[model samples]
Target: MSLQVPRNGKVCVIGSGVAGLTFSYLLNQLRPDVHIDIYEKQERSGGWLNSHHREVNGSKVMLERGPRTLRGKSDGSIVMIDIMRRLGQLSQVQYVGKKSQANRQFLLNGQGRLVEVPKNWTQFAKFVMDPISGGLVRGMAHDLLHCKRLDRKTYEDESVGQLLARRFGSTEIGDRIISGIYHGIYAGDMNEMSSLHTGRRFVEDEMKYGSFVRGMFSGLGAKPSEILSGELMEYNRSIGGQTQHNWTEFARRVKQSAMLGFAGGLEQYPLALRAYLEKQQQVRLRLGQAVASVLPGTGQNVVVNGVHYDHVRSTLNPSAMAAIFPEIQGLQHGDFKSVSVYIMNVYVPGTNLIRDAIAGFGYLVPQRSSQGDGLLGVIFDSVVERNYLNWQTQLPRHQDDCTKMTLMVGGHYLNKGLHLDLHKCLGHVSNHLGVDLAAYNPVTQNLLARDGIPVFDVGFDKKAARVVEECTRLYAGHVTLGGVGFARGPGVPDVVMHELAAVLHA
Candidate 1:
C-alpha cells in the first residue's frame, strides 16, 4: 500500500516522549518525502530521561535526577542500542561493571525498626519461617505456586491483591511484599492493578515450576553450561555496545539532534522532535493544539486542532488512529494526576562516597518501608562512569576531604504531599552516611512532574486495546502510538524503536 502524498503530505505526531520522537524518526527515515509534524505538549522533549551536571570544588559531577539507570536486558533495550549505534555514539555507551552492594532493602517491623533483606536462602528461610512472616509467605506461596491453573482468559483481568490473597494466604507478609513491589515500581496499590498485566511472568514461572522455590532453584540454574560458556560472545553481540554502556553515556548517545536545558528539563525531548519536524519543509508542528476531536474522512482521516489546525489530512492507519481519537468530543481522554518531586544534588568537598565506581548504580525504596515520608532512591553519580568524572585514574582526593553526592528524595503521592516531612528522611540518610548536608554546597533542586508516569489500572489493558483498535479503524493505514503507556521499564526507547520497526515492516 503506497502512502498517498499530496504536493506536500504532512504527518502530525502527538506527544514528544520517546515514543513520539522515535515514531517521527522512523517515519522520516522510511518516508522522508512525507512531511512529519510532531506536536509536543511540553516545551521540550526527552520525557523522563534527563540529566544534569554541576562543578564542585573545580570537579564536574553529573546528576541524573530522573531515570538514573537503564536496563541491559529486554528487547526494547536492543532498540535503544541500535539507535545509539546509528547515531555514532555507540562507543560512549557504558554499563555498570560491578553491581551495587546496597542490598539494604528494609521492611518495617510492627515496631518500625528497619531490618535488612535476607541475603541468602538460609536467611530467607529463617525470616519467612518466623511465626509472623512465615505463615503469610507459606500461604502466599501455596496460592501462587500450588493453586490450580487459572483460566488464562479470565485471569488477565484479575486484581493483583485478589489473586494473591486467593492463591496465597492473605497474610501480612504477602501483603507487605506485594505492596512493596507495587510501590517500588508503579507507586500504586495492588488492589487496583491487574495481576496478569503486572505479574504475568511471575505467574507463568510459578505455574510452570509448580512452586516458587522449585522454580527459583531449577529455572535459575537450568541454563545450559554450553550457553553459559558463550556468555562473552552473547554479550558482545547484544545492542547498546557490549552491555557496558553506563546511563550518562547512553543518554548522551541516544540524544541525537536534541537540545538539552535545565529550564524545560524533560520537555526538551518532545520539543526537539517538534523543532526537527518544523525544520523539514514537509513537516509542521502545532503546539498547544490539543486534539479535541477526530472523525473518519473519505479514504483519509480528519483531525480537529485549534484555529491553526482546523482540519488536516491524517496519513495514518485510519482505524488505529480512530481508536485512540474516538468520537469528536474527546470522551476518550483518560484522567491523570500530576506528581512533583524535588531532587537535591549535594556536592561534598572531598568524600569518595563510592569506593568502586561500577558498584554505585543506585537503590530503590520499597513502598512498604517508605515510612510515610521517605526518599525514593539514591543514584551514585560518581560510580556511574560518565564524562563528568575521570574514573580510569586513581582519585588524588582523600576520603576525608570531600566528594559529591546526589540525593533524590520524594515523588510518590505520600512523599510529595508531605514534602515538609522529607527533612527528617533526608536527615536520617545523611546521618547514616555520616555526611553533613549543610557542609556541602547544594547544587540544584529540580522539581519534575510527579504525575510523570501513567497509572495502569485493572482495565487499562482493555482501554488501551480499544484505543488502538479505534485508531486502526479510523486512520486505516496511518498513525501509531508508542511510549511508556504502551510499554514499561527503563528501556522505553528500546520499546519505541522496536515498535517503530515492526510498524515499518508491517
Candidate 2:
C-alpha cells in the first residue's frame, strides 16, 4: 500500500544510530503530518546499548558484551532520560546510591600487580610520599594544575600525550596514567591520539583553572552535592581503589524502554528507527537499495526506479540523496574502516567477587599492554548496579546462586586474530578473577562492529569540513548526516537535531 501524508511533505532519512533515531523522533513529533521514511541496512535497533541474559550454572544471569553503561550525567543521558519519560519507562530507571566496593580500581603495572588508584587525601599523600613514585606524581599534579593555554587553532591538532607530557613533564607515572585513560576510553594509543579531540575536557578545564587539582578542588568545594552524587566521585574512588564498575545493569536499563532496543547489539537502534518509519502510513523505507548515481534534475520530476519522483512536492532532500547515491561520480566518499571487537560475558559463581555497584563499570586495556594475552577488562555486573541483583538485599551471599561476573575482551585496536579464540580469552579472564569458568553453565560471546567512531588524526577537522562542504555542494538541500562520527558523545544528538531542524525549516 502506498503511504500518503495529509498535507506535510514526504521525507527520507538514512542510517539508524542514536543520532538517526533521535533525529527522526524529533522530526515526527514536530510535524506529525510530514511523511518520513527511514532506511537501515540492519533489521533491528539500539546501536551499542545491547544486553543479553542466559542460564549459567542454574542461575539466570544477564550479560552485556557491548556498551554496558551510559554516563549518567552526560547531555546524551539527559536526552535519553527525557525520551524514556515520554515513553513511560522513566520509573524503571533507578540509581544505586554510592556503594563502597565499586570504588576499587587498579592500574596493571608492568609487574602485574594491580596498583590501586588514590581515593582520598591520605591515599594521594601516600602515593606522592613514596620516594620511587613521588616525583612523577608531583610533576603530573603540578602540570595538570598549572599548564599554560595555547592558541585554540593549534590546540585541536595536538596529540593528547604531547599535551600531557608538555604540561606535566614526561614522567613514568604521568605517562602510565595517560596511557591507561586513553586505552580505557578510545581503545586507541594515547601518543598518536589528538588531545584536542579526546582530552578536550581536561585541556579546557586546565586552561580555565590552570591546574586539574585546582579545578577539582574548586569544583568539589562549590557543588559538593552534585559532584558527590555524580560519576566523577565514583571515578575518583575507582582510581583510588584500583577497580572499574560493571556497566551491564546500566546498559540494560537504557535498553528496556520501548523507545530503545538492541536486537543486534548497538547497531540495532538505527535499524529500529528505520522500521518505525516504514510502519508509518506517512513514511517509506528502502533497504539494499543503494543509490547507484545522482544527477541534476529539474522541476518536480526526477527519474528514480524508472518513475519520476516529485522533488518540490516531496519533503525528502533530493540533493542529499543524490550526493550519497552510489552512482554519483566526482565526490569523495568518507574514509571508513570495518573494526571487529570481541566480547566475553563471564558469569563467576560462588563468590561475592564484586561488592560495590560502581566497582565493575569495567576497565580499558592500555595499548602498551596489548602484547599480553590478558583481556581488556572485567566488569562485575552484579556489583556495578543493584538493579541487576536478584534480591533486594544490599549484598548477595557468597553461596547465593544469583551472583555472576561479566568480562569484555579485545577491541578494534587489539589484534583481531586473538579475539577469535574465545576459550583462551575466557581462561585468561578466569585467571584474573581467581575463579574457574567451568563452574558456570553458559558463557556468552559476541562480536560487533565499531562503525562511525570518528578517527581524529592530525588534520581531522579539515578533512571533516571538506566532506561537509562537498556534501553541501553536491546534495544541496537533500541529504542529512548525523552521528558520533560527526560529533562525539551524548552531545551529538542535540547538535544534529538543531542543525537538521534549521535545515528543514529553511
The model with the greatest lDDT is 1
List lDDT for all candidates, in order: 0.49, 0.48
Q: Model 1 over residues 388-424: C-alpha lDDT tens digits?
A: 2112231222223334455555544543356445456
lDDT of 2 by residue, 1-506 (tens): 11222356655545454655665665675567776554555554444545565676576555665665444434344344444444444443433332335435555444333445676778667655543353465676667656565555555567777766666666454445657765555555566666666677767766777666556666653431222223323322322122224233343343332122122223333334455555667666555444433333454333333433322112112223334455433223444322334556655555555434224444444444443553555555555543332212323223353444555444444533543466776665555455565665544656554432334544545554665555445444343345554455323333333334332442
For candidate 1, the per-residue lDDT at 312 reads 35
Candidate 1 achieves a global lDDT of 0.49
Reference-based lDDT, residue 378, model 2: 58
Off by over 4 Å in 1: 1-9, 55-59, 98-146, 206-211, 224-298, 304-342, 353-360, 385-420, 431-436, 439-444, 474-477, 488-494
Question: 227, model 2: CA deviation in Å?
Answer: 14
